[model samples]
Target chain A: MSRLDDALREALRREEPPEGFAGRVMARIEARKERAGAWDGLMAAWRGPRLRWAGALAGAVLLIGTAAYQETQRAEGEQAKRQVMLALRITGAKLDLARARIQRVGYGLGDR
Target chain B: MRIAIVVLAATLGTAWAQDIKMPPAFDKLAAKAEESVDVTLDSGMLQLGGKFLSDKDADEAKAKKLIGGLKGIYVRSFEFAKEGEYSAADVDALRSQLQPPVWSRVVGVTSKKGGEITEVYFKTSNGAQIGGLVVIDAEPKELTVVSISGAISPEDLADLGGQFGIPKVELPKSKGKEAK
Candidate 1:
């Protein structure tokens, strides 16, 4: 292997990210939770009902909107696909015409 | 009656708006191949664009017959099955190809929804634009490229719609075994 290939292989061989990576990540998450504290937890509980209701309503709206949008997109995509196909057909026809012209040119040259 | 008229008007408007348009033709000769690549070449740094392949392929003769009139080939593609399947380093490899005196950066547009990055480049010949390139790093579900070459007109590109052998509009009653 070339130097670049060797280097790439070496890099690939060292698959492990780093030592204590998971521990460090967990510790950071725990620290954040501690800083958030009991008051934060209490507030979350108090707002839980309202938040659930709001989330449900938002989800319903989002689902409906997404369905409508997806339908429109599907229709548009179909239309565009059709257009592209048509374009290719037309282009193909033009190529046939050009080939005929070239053949005519060849024939003319032969006659000379 | 008023509602019906309003609906009809809206439908007509939409149809008009969606009408396929073509660009103006110049003295330049752009061949019509079975597969077309619309490339915008500025300089040595090439930015590959778009490709249209013919649906039918029987043999080399047929393929050549279909592609004989084509002028250029353009391809914008990406390979990714899952999230984070590709990394910055992979993109950097592509970017590295466009580095320095050959190509200069113009714009980089990243879309979080599709997890794609489109970087546009200008080919420099003594700091002049002789070509253009766009690299799109996209997920399997979302990838697209638009390439043009040889004095291409935007209008022609738009009109290119419906010229290829795309399926035709069929009514529900006519839908038979072919529908599947």
Candidate 2:
């Protein structure tokens, strides 16, 4: 669309890497692989029994914490159940009293 | 003196015993409830709804038996990270369900504070009471719907609070456990 754009496009043309680029890339990749392998071997050797024991201890603590949480939930549920039963019992008793009062009133009216 | 105290406690405990024996099935149903809702079906009319919290340890057979006694159970819940996620269209959809031959809308109350609309409906069959429905629109907080069926006294409905476990009345204390 413009002469400036055409000149810029001509100035910048696509080109391949140098002839030894492929070989240089392969050499770098091999070096990285060797370094990674050695690092992994070193890490495995450094991981002693103490580290394993620490991991296991942490896991056990987590398990115990989970169990305690579950027990607390269970206890709360039981307490709620007890409260509900008590309330229901009270309501039933009140209804009974109301019924009795009504019956007494009816009997008194009959006597009159 | 201890014997007298024990006798008095026994007497009080016997008097405090519940008269109405709610069916065992109802007990199981109450146990399953997680959250209980209370709303006035109409201005001065009351209704209650309970949401049961499902549990893996729950007895399936017993829960089923308890649910079977219930005439109607309806639930409508919305989850939003922020407020104002719902529109009037959502409420209208629910209102439409309460329309027609089944229910007659009695009153509609709207609140300016929360933009909440409470619509009450009464259901009848041959001019006799059957059921009632209540739709509440509360924004930025919560929304609730309560559907009540069977012959529930209006007075009893008004007494219901958030606690769904059971009703409490003054009762005599028990003494037999103390002796043991």
Candidate 3:
């Protein structure tokens, strides 16, 4: 029992720490604080209004680009439709003129 | 060498199938014309234009239906300030391409008083169905050549003429009537 008590006393004795031990512990705590601060800063930036504004701006740009593309396509389609109508008009007029002339010439069926 | 020749022959044979090879003189005429219109719509453009056409509108709906089966529509028209901006040789060059066995002259009319000549040709496939149509209208002051390729029937032609304020001509339904 005495031997166990001596061992316990030696193990639990309050002795002065080694040189710079407190300084090293304090330095390690400061480093941990700095790491936490950097992570918080990054999170704060993500949660800030600047990021929201940037996202909104990107969305607006995408929407405007899509609208502009559709408008250009519509304009091209309108032009193509007009040209098609004109071509068909000219073709029909020519055919009609030829038919009239053929009827006048007494070539009834226009087989030639 | 044999494969190369076969490939080239196949390419040329496909080109000569239905489409008309416009003469180079058309470019010269276009440059000299007071007003010119050149519309070249391949199948892609036609399909795109057809998409934009409104089905509710009668004219657009009719046009959409007409262009549905068409592969291409090429029209070149020029109006000159003077009467002799183009020569007969230019017209003849285009006419020479419309040879027989594939193309047949269906209608030809010459008006001396009006100084106009109009010829219509049909491209027949499999000796039965009309695969294409070409119309050449040459006037004293204007010239227009229209070539439409792909499947088109005589009824479709009549419908096209009937629409767009053009008077409709009665075409005989029977192939026997068209036999020359």
Please give, for residues A4-108, the per-residue lDDT of candidate 2 as tens digits. 999989888877898999999999999999999999888776677667988998999999999998777666544433333233233333333322232332321
Candidate 2's TM-score reads 0.32
Better of 1 and 3 by DockQ: 3
Every model's TM-score: 0.26, 0.32, 0.77
Give per-residue lDDT, candidate 2, residue A95. Answer: 34
Candidates sorted on lDDT, descending: 3, 2, 1
Each candidate's DockQ? 0.03, 0.01, 0.23
Provide the clashing-pair count of each candidate structure: 31, 0, 0
lDDT of 3 at B179: 14
* Candidate 2 residue pairs in clash (backbone atoms < 3 Å): none
Q: Residue A67's C-alpha lDDT in candidate 2?
A: 91
Runs in model 3 with CA error above 4 Å?
A1-43, A109-112, B1-18, B167-180
lDDT of 1 at B19: 14
RMSD (Cα, Å) of model 2: 23.5
Q: Name the lDDT of candidate 3.
A: 0.83
Off by over 4 Å in 1: A1-112, B1-76, B79-81, B112-114, B126-129, B140-180
Give fnat (model 1): 0.07
- Candidate 3, residues A1-112, lDDT tens digits: the string is 6999999999999989999999999999999999999989988987897789989999999999999999999988888888778878888877777766666666644355
